[model samples]
Target: MSDIEFPDTLIALERAAWEELQAGRLTVATANAVQDAITQHAEAAGMSRVEVEMALKKAVRHAEG
Candidate 1:
């Protein structure tokens, strides 16, 4: 489990962006939204961008449903 609690906005943007990526239809706007959200979340949470991103990926992809 991750110690960091990411915001729903960031998670949703990332999830949507990821789906676009898989479809090879990712737009610059979507990618930039995810990037911007990540940076904001990292700054707000006082964690490195990479740490937050990795934790987010694990949370989204590996979390048991």
Candidate 2:
């Protein structure tokens, strides 16, 4: 649903983080790791961190079945 090429590892991390957030188990380390991954992905893709993060979240949280 998105044009962004999200890395599987990044998606996994974000999914895990999302689950943690849902269960109130989110930690600083996990959140930071997701942010780091997003930053790296944005740099590698030559896109802004905001754009990459938005697309990634949509893909992860709002994907169609």
Candidate 3:
């Protein structure tokens, strides 16, 4: 077993979320669907879908890494 410590911060949270997604806690398709939903919500609120997707991709990579 590894005894690695995770950092604490907004980035860390994003990383953790990513790790969960990678660990079969979430499926890639499900993540895409969730991102779609988030995009819809953000669009309704006049936000940027591209930005949201970028963040989502970043988190996903962290989890996958």
TM-score of each: 0.87, 0.96, 0.38
Weakest 10 consecutive residues of candidate 2 by summed lDDT: 1-10
Model 2 CA lDDT for position 55: 94
lDDT of each: 0.87, 0.95, 0.53
Candidate 2 regions with alpha-carbon error over 4 angstroms:
none
lDDT of 3 at 20: 75
Against the true structure, candidate 1 has what lDDT? 0.87
Q: Candidate 3, residue 43: CA error in Å?
A: 1.1
How far does residue 25 in candidate 2 sit from its true spot (Å)? Answer: 1.1
* Segments in model 1 whose C-alpha atoms lie over 4 Å from true places: none
Please, what are the lDDT tens digits per residue for candidate 3 over residues 1-65? 11222223333444555777668696666556556565664576576766655665555464553
What's the true lDDT of residue 48 in model 2?
A: 96
Please give the ranking of all candidate structures by TM-score, highest first, separated by commas: 2, 1, 3
Off by over 4 Å in 3: 1-19, 22-25, 53-65
Q: Between prediction 1 and prediction 2, which has the larger TM-score?
A: 2
Q: List the residue pairs that clash in candidate 1.
A: none
